[model samples]
Target chain A: MSEFKQADHKLLVIPGPIEFSDPVLLANATPGTAHTSPAFIPVFGESLKLLRKVLESTEESGSQPILIAGSGTLGWDAVGVNLVQRGDEVVVLNTGYFGDSFAECLEIYGAKVNQVKAEVGDIPSDDAIIKALSSKPKVITITHVDTSTGVLSPAAHIASLVKKHSPDTLIVLDAVCSVASEEIKFDEWGLDVVISATQKGLGVPPGLSVVLASKRAVEVSEKLTPQGYYISWKKWIPIMKNYEAGKPSYFATPPVQLVYALNTSLKSITSKPISERVEAHKAASKYVKDELSAIGLDFVPKNRDIAANGMTAVRFPQGLKAPDVLPKLAERDIVVAAGLHKAIVTEYFRIGHMGVTAVDRQRGDLEKVINGIKEVLGKNKD
Target chain B: MSEFKQADHKLLVIPGPIEFSDPVLLANATPGTAHTSPAFIPVFGESLKLLRKVLESTEESGSQPILIAGSGTLGWDAVGVNLVQRGDEVVVLNTGYFGDSFAECLEIYGAKVNQVKAEVGDIPSDDAIIKALSSKPKVITITHVDTSTGVLSPAAHIASLVKKHSPDTLIVLDAVCSVASEEIKFDEWGLDVVISATQKGLGVPPGLSVVLASKRAVEVSEKLTPQGYYISWKKWIPIMKNYEAGKPSYFATPPVQLVYALNTSLKSITSKPISERVEAHKAASKYVKDELSAIGLDFVPKNRDIAANGMTAVRFPQGLKAPDVLPKLAERDIVVAAGLHKAIVTEYFRIGHMGVTAVDRQRGDLEKVINGIKEVLGKNKD
Candidate 1:
């Protein structure tokens, strides 16, 4: 019964399910830990500490991490619905797909979205963003990395622009793939909110979405009109306060096994300097991009400086499409993602080198994919 | 970096995290499975089918199980907010502390609660419930087993009474700790909704809560006046329908690791006759109760028939407090729960024996707890 009955050998080469260390997988199997034991509280408390560390929050005073069950997508809804009241003006820096998703989530709550649109694969200039906030929005939202197109926005720099332009507007960052992969200084960047998922750089399985809120974010949430009950920040803050105070009141039952896995993953992050981990992802990304170049492939992002360090976006040769190249790679048991946004879908494919990914566990697969692409395109190279 | 840090080896002899099989623990460590793969869909589909079988529902009809994050407490909120609206009258068969909690959740949403109050450890009679529902309330809520006092209410008999008397009223059953340990026939008894969690009888680490809905329950939920988005039954029904149609939507990121563990635990339950598993729990309960009788202890609930097979409630001999007994048991690495409801706090303690509580797992631990209690109470054993 304990054996991996169905999917034992099939590797999950998705950006997530990256090559997790054996220890992280074993963490989910740790026997029963009391949910209310004094021993368990420190484990819970330590998890938040590591979370803040991973996000590179300089001051200890930002919002504490609130762990909820579900996906990073849920985090978008939570941030939008919790603080954005109906008729509120929210400025959105639309770098790629996820920024528009955050905007759509805001629209669901009846907030008006003002978009500062960046060209595909390009970062939004501080001037363009400053002009967008001229109308004085109550909130300014942006993505740290648009996973859809493998574009990394300069969140820390953009956040400073918001602070200088509109001090009253809350700055929310979607660091779903960038918190542990890229350098995100929440406190230095003047970020009011940050959100991420477990499956990404945190190196656990999917389920829990972690949201870190600033004191300003908490204050704004309290004054905002009640957005319904279950997903409300108003309902969550008190419960989280009580949990930190050692009175466990669960608004929803946490996925216990997933939390256990996260607890293990966070403990590892705290043990090492988080900056080293970020550098490791940078090194892996360089390795992938370097190998692709050795084989004569060009990167999709024209400006290489703006490319995400956790994953690489590369275009197929002019005649070859992703649909044609993907299956050829799959024949060797490798899986890479097709481009996600409307503008890039026919042009590029992304290879992730985040969390748990190493040159060792995956270099062979990466080589096979590179060789497969060469063999197929090599035929046309003649 | 993610390895299993050893938890304080405190055995959760509490109502949840009850002893689980070795294989079930190992099942959780299995690697990620595709959420949409044909290989993975049947695991989801089969789990739902087995759940229906355990509840004795029709394969073609009856209630279908919808899994979500959090504990059984969320299930109560989902049922209350979805079925009861402002000005709706709902009757609660208040047998213990959880009954009061169920009523409180309903009251939060503007439903008027009509409680058929029974003393702690007492089950309301069918006639009593019928009389309370004479006003034709919209729903009648009851706990299948109140973990507080280790009492099993007559859920089937009561659901039958609701059908006979208040035909329009939906019957909601809180089967949190009792579903896998005891018997619940949803279709045969015409119960509208039954909620349970993974930590108890399902024998996985806590996180997922299940709310199984009948056709009538779904209809009532759809008719609710302005259901909130997060906990809306309407939101779930469509997702569940897609799952049934062989495609599951991303309602929220599922706690993937916990889902894997649950699939393993549930498959074990359905591999054999469910009746045999219920019988095993019954045998274990009787064995523990027999040992308690040998040591001159008295059980709290009046009838053995109504005592929960999952947990047993017992009053210590006249001068002994459970506070003295609980820590001593903990010193021996065994954990047990003190009373939960206000009325029974000083007089009783609970020993849970569900979820992978086969004879081998229970015999040694049960004996250690019983002997620890004997040693603590030896001063007053007269």
Candidate 2:
């Protein structure tokens, strides 16, 4: 704890760009290193290898990890451009704001999208998804954990359903908010693609779009005429293969410092069994949810089982609003997110507990959050 | 000098991901800050304002600076998707590798690209450009400095020619290798768009696609249906405007740390007159060219006037190749890039003198590069 010498600032308890470890921050400060230099190549290669371990995917399963310099939204573009051709059928399992946006993105790229949308704070019903799947969509996208609503969809069940019904359909998981905080068995769950970014559970600065593609996904991409220049899988696949083989390659210049920071965070995350990390998040979530429940708060997700472990979306107490609680939290040096999901935009707010805040209990970050909320609510009651 | 406490490593003299200053690297190490946090809003806002100052663009002229989380290649995608609709006629003035690639990118997005080609290490002839413009292309693209061959095209001249030949044609400058290192008066030159990245003349780690678009470009983009999701001007324009107004807004997440580093570098770069920085690059380019010439080496560019001010592409002396010179320089803890142009790949190499290397004389970076080159060439002669 003493080694954490970062300048004093308010705790960033937002869903992403979460608190980073000291080592990760220092790694981000790496001196300028050429993307193709021998020294930087292995850093990139190891990061790729470690990503496989984190997702429980393997080269043996023909899963490839891609790290590009962009936001996670770019991951949606990669899917829309590389996987879906003009007028191809795609089923988007709409959980929250991200689902709507992903569907819109696929539509822009000419995908004929059928979105299965539930009411806000809930996942689409299995019956609706099966109905959408019966159309034999070319791809089905699921948001593992939608940050906007803190709804954790049952990914494995959906993947199993997809395999049983539309066996040839690709299963794409938007794991931007779930990857390091939740249990993701990419190969075991039969996920064809998992799209993510570095800032959330990965505990790095926000710059990289981290993605994994199955062999079938890559093969389908190869058959298509490249629609976008920067997001083309055909160009990036060779570069990823070369870097992972301990050789220097280039499609475009990578963000050198961000990759270094990602490598450092991956090492720390993979140091322990990923299951242990997921369990730690579960513990933190329980702690936070139980405390908030005691304060008479209702959550955005319909039930405990559906809520995300890394983040919580809590509705303001009846008669209280963002102005009343959020400002008080800010005064306490804590920062949480205002609610998204246009259906209930002003009803709730979000707090993120992932990475060091959840896994490193010595930091007592969750306690700070719970106490700050309690104090704010206590004053409101007065 | 005492304030520079970065870890000891080989100097990065490549054209991009060049040596960053201590302040910029340290800023990159900033603790996690949310993209929309009050603390970060000003950093992002100031960076946008500073970018206009660096480019000599003003809000009054309706020029906008866009900073996104991607490489310079993404800038090409933005132009292709935003400005070029299906069957749009565009002219690419091919100087080197980047020109061909930019044309390829534009074509992928449905532009009918007409490329005006020149021989290796030379800009396109005015007559060829005029001929291409006779088609009344929608846009004319120029690589301000093609990193592949170190050829610095006369961007102002081309923009003026485009205006004369086809008044409605947009002028796009790919300044990936020339932004802060060269003179660019966006309004004065009537450039509709200038595409760049942070790693090169900006002296920051690679991750950001920094672009500037004129009012006409924005208005033109708004008229077209967005072709790409992540690079959409319609989506980003509001976000950029909101941030510049010191307000928190989001389209996709910005790279918070990279934006911080970019702000640090931009503040430093704009501290003095931009002309002074350009002249420094000029002085460094002349010094390197003179030293190499004295050592009996020629350059890829046809003459000194047309060569890039930030980097030099020098041909190996008789019987010398990259293998004979680059590895020797690497041994001296100096790193440079091998030649990239396919036509003269084995005959030359590129050395970057930008940012701190070109501007901070106390660092003696250029002297070290020249001395190392002289030693490597002398050993080859012996």
Candidate 3:
């Protein structure tokens, strides 16, 4: 019996909460240490430092990093509560479901949202963002990579546009699915706030949310306040400052084991050039797309350049529901996600290729998925 | 030399994030698994079932349990967002820091808070809570064990009072520090909402917040229009229903590795006689208090009956800050928490003796703490 049953066995090939590395998984399972214990601080500090490197941020040398205990969705609330005051106009560059979620959160805080919607598989152009910023919104929110549609936004270009057209507007980028999969240049690209998660590209289990902010984001946050207490940035900064001085403090009890797993995963990333890891994701994504092309299926995103290296959204054959195809794939031990947006859920399903997924063993899993999909379709065809 | 130099070698003797079993630690450190995988659901479902058993709540058998990505603090917000509405009158039974935090979260959601403050070392009497509930508040919040002062409130008594005085007022119990250490009959005690954490009594890392709500609490939450999204109880119930039916869904990515660790920990707790674990905690706490009395030091909560078995709060001798005695204890490979509340930071320190700490070996460490305190006080007096 092995003390457990295999009827519960599932292989996740979905967008986020991807498979974890053995060491990382073991690290996650480790018992927790006190947040302020000498054993925990170094690991916590090291995790923050490595995150700064992963995001390529200016925050490493100057600004403090705030790690909150929630989903990446909390980042939208944090930014809105900390920087967007009542009646403040915010421009949202919408690429997928996450962009709409961000806009909704901002609207809840009484911020007027002006959205520039990008096509399903395409990122918003710099010209569109520049035009939107002509009205001088206080903040410009961009989705670096939208997990919902498997699209990667042109964050660097949008950041440049914001800097050139509206210098005072803060640029917040959602890098939840992109941080480990794609190249994020926070300092070079002038990103004010870069949001990430433990799942997805980081290869850790979900639970903790990482928000890396520039000095400008912190400075702007001080000028705003919201009724919400749990997602308050002002409440987190002082503790983070204490952390920078080598003392760990908590606004809430943190997910200690998750952070430990993240530390191990972050260290693994730093062991070699991070770009190589990003390229591995790129190569796996390309290999899957090549297979998809051979299967006579088309990718949801028409533009190859805008498609994220971490995940791919493909339109299933006409008349077959994406939901129906998911369970069929599951029968073969593969897990894939249905499209998030209501507009496309029936037409498309997403395949995630992130974290330790590009390795030889995982590549074999990907190959299994490719062959498995073809087999299922062959069996279903009349 | 290790890649990281400062290793945490001290035993955690604070109220929470206590020492865990080696097996539990090892289980937590094991690599991650996807939460939605067929393998994860059975474990997750079994863990939920076992959790209800630990709580002695038959009413919670089929009621949905949501494991959110955060500490126990998130539990308060979850309750507030899901059940509280603007202009609702809420009664707070405050004994320590966490009680105040709960009140703060409720007030933010526009609830009118009426606080019934209990003395530092005393649990509020049923008469006092009845008096507070005279206004017919919508919800009544109390902590089962306040980590700040090591006080265990008469939660069942308070719940009984609420039922008598204001049946409509839902009784919410913060069991963050007491769940595994003390005997709690959630259904028998008439507790509407029981909030607990993975670190303290559960013996897992601090990442996932486990909440068990009664049928009445869920009914009240269904009436609420979801004050916010991520903390929405409405969104969770349907998904939980779907998951229990064999189709798992997630609002945000859960920490997969932490879930694995929690699963193992939950198994251990329910596998053995539940009374044995509770008795171990009580015996360890008695030993700590007896040692403190033998050393001529006074305990923080004077009344032994109202004190929590998970931790012992002690008064630091005059001429020394709690911080001063902490380093000496740390030097002896033991860790204790300095005073937390603004009102008592200089005069107190907390020693946690929960989780695996109930075993015999912990007594040696407890003795070391007593000696460390004696030496520090003697040196400072000279």
Candidate 4:
């Protein structure tokens, strides 16, 4: 323990860019290290290996973890340019804002996107997804946890459906909001790809794009001519393989400080059983939703079963919009997010309870958020 | 100032991910801040403004600076997908490896590329570039400093030639290794785009791709239907405009911590006159080259005038290779990079003297590198 303390500030409870651990921040403060330095090769290599553990992927499963220095959106570009050729059909399970954006991205890359849109605050129905698969689309994308509405789709169930109905269809899960907070069994779920980022449940700052591609996804990509350079699998696959083998290789310069932070975070995350971490997030989400419900608040997700473990989206009291609630919470030194879905942007607000706030009970971050919301709502009631 | 110290580690003297100042590293250690937080908005806004100052671009010049979370190579993709349509003719001034890679990226996006080849360790000749311009190519790219060969192309001179011969052609400068270490007058030179990254001369960790595009370039990009979603100016232009006006905006999440580091570094850099910083690099380069020449060492760049000021590529003595020299320097606690250009991979090694190493004499880093190399080679003479 270095006894270094960060300066006190407002608690950040956004859906992503969640609160990070002290050791992770210290790692980010590292002196400059060359991306290909002998000292850094192992750090990069270890991070790749640890990502497999987090996603429940295995070398035996031929799942490769690709780490790139970009935001989570870059992972979408990776999938769009590499896996989807011109005139390929992709089915998007639309849950919220992210699903719509992902569909647009695939369309830009020449995929004829067939979106199975759900009603507001709900997951897409099973029948609609199966019907969309009638055409035997080349790939299907599911937002595992839609940040805009706090809806957690049945990813494993959807993958099972794809396997049963359209055996050749590849499953791509946008796990940006759910990676460490939710349970993701990559091999067991038969998922072809899981796209994520560092800031959400990984408990690091926002900079890296983490994508895991199964053996089948790799094969599909290799058959196509690459359309983009920076996101091409052909350029990055060898680099990732060499790094995970503890060798120095370069396609592009990795973000040294962020990778160090990720290595420190993954070590702490894998120190305990992943199931325990998922249960912790479940407990935190349950506690937050129960407290808000006691205050007569509604949720963006229609039911508890579909609500995400990492965050909660609660509708405001009658006659109150975001302006009436979000700033009041900020004044109490708590930071929550305004709603993102265009349909209900001003009607609800979101509170994140992932990573340290959910897993480490001693932090008391959940209590601070709950109490702050209670006090503010009490005043508004008067 | 706070008394926080990073742990002692080996000095990083690579071309990028160079030695960062303590304050910049401390900034990278920042607690998590929401990308749209009020406190972070100004930091991002100020970073955009300072980037303009560093590049000598002005508000009146209609030049826009875009900061995204990715490596320097991502900047090449941004240029490729945004500006080039099918069968657009492009002339690439091939100085070294990066030029070839940039040409490949453009071709992937459907450009018909014409590369003007240069001799090994030399810049493209003016006569060749003039002949290539006869067809009036849609765009021409110049690599400001090719890190592979340590050859510095005359960027301003190339822009002048392009203006005289092909006035309508867009000029894109790959300044991945040159910005902040060399002088760039964007508006005065009539340049349309300058692509760079944070790690090189900006003295920050490697996570950000900093690109400045002129108003004409933006207009040109708008005329073409976007082929990419993540790299599209349509999605990012509004976001950048809003962030620069101190408002919250989001297309994709910006790398928050790295942006903070960039702001701190740009403040320290522009705190002194930029000309003074350029002169410091020049002085450091002169000293390193003189010392090596006195030891009877040859350089990768054909002469001093065409050599990069931030780094030096020195050919090994007869009968010696990288294994005989690099490890010897490492044993003395000094680190230098091996050659990267394929044509001369084993014949030479590189030493970086930019950012704090060149600007802050108090650190005495340049002296350590010079002395360590001298001692190692002195023993080889035996």
Mind giving the per-residue lDDT tens digits that candidate 1 earns over B109-188? 66899988887777887778878989999888888888888888878788778888888898889998888888888888
In terms of lDDT, the poorest run of 10 residues in model 4 chain B is: B1-10
Q: How does candidate 3 score on lDDT? A: 0.78
Error of 2 at B57 (Å): 0.6
Task: Using lDDT, give the best candidate's number.
Answer: 2
CAPRI quality of model 2 = medium
The residue ranges of model 2 lying beyond 4 angstroms of the native Cα positions read A1-8, A379-382, B1-8, B379-382
Q: Could you tell me how far off, in angstroms, the CA of residue B34 lies in candidate 2 after the best superposition?
A: 1.1
Model 3 agreement with the true structure over A126-244: per-residue lDDT tens digits: 78887899999999998888888888887877788888899989888888888888988888888888888878888887888889888878887776655467777777778766665
Model 4: per-residue Cα lDDT at residue A192: 96
Residue-level lDDT of model 4, residues A293-333, one tens digit each, is 88889999999999999999999999988888789888887
Question: Which pairs clash in the backbone of model 1?
Answer: A23-B2, A24-B2, A63-A213, A253-B70, A253-B71, A254-B207, A255-B207, A256-B206
Residue pairs with clashing backbones, model 4: none
In CAPRI terms, where does candidate 1 land? acceptable
In the order shown, the candidates' DockQ scores are: 0.35, 0.73, 0.42, 0.73
Clash number for every model? Answer: 8, 0, 22, 0
Which ranges of candidate 3 are over 4 A from the true structure? A1-11, A60-63, A124-131, A317-333, A359-382, B1-9, B60-64, B125-127, B272-276, B317-324, B359-382
Better of 1 and 3 by lDDT: 3
Q: What DockQ would candidate 3 receive versus the native complex?
A: 0.42
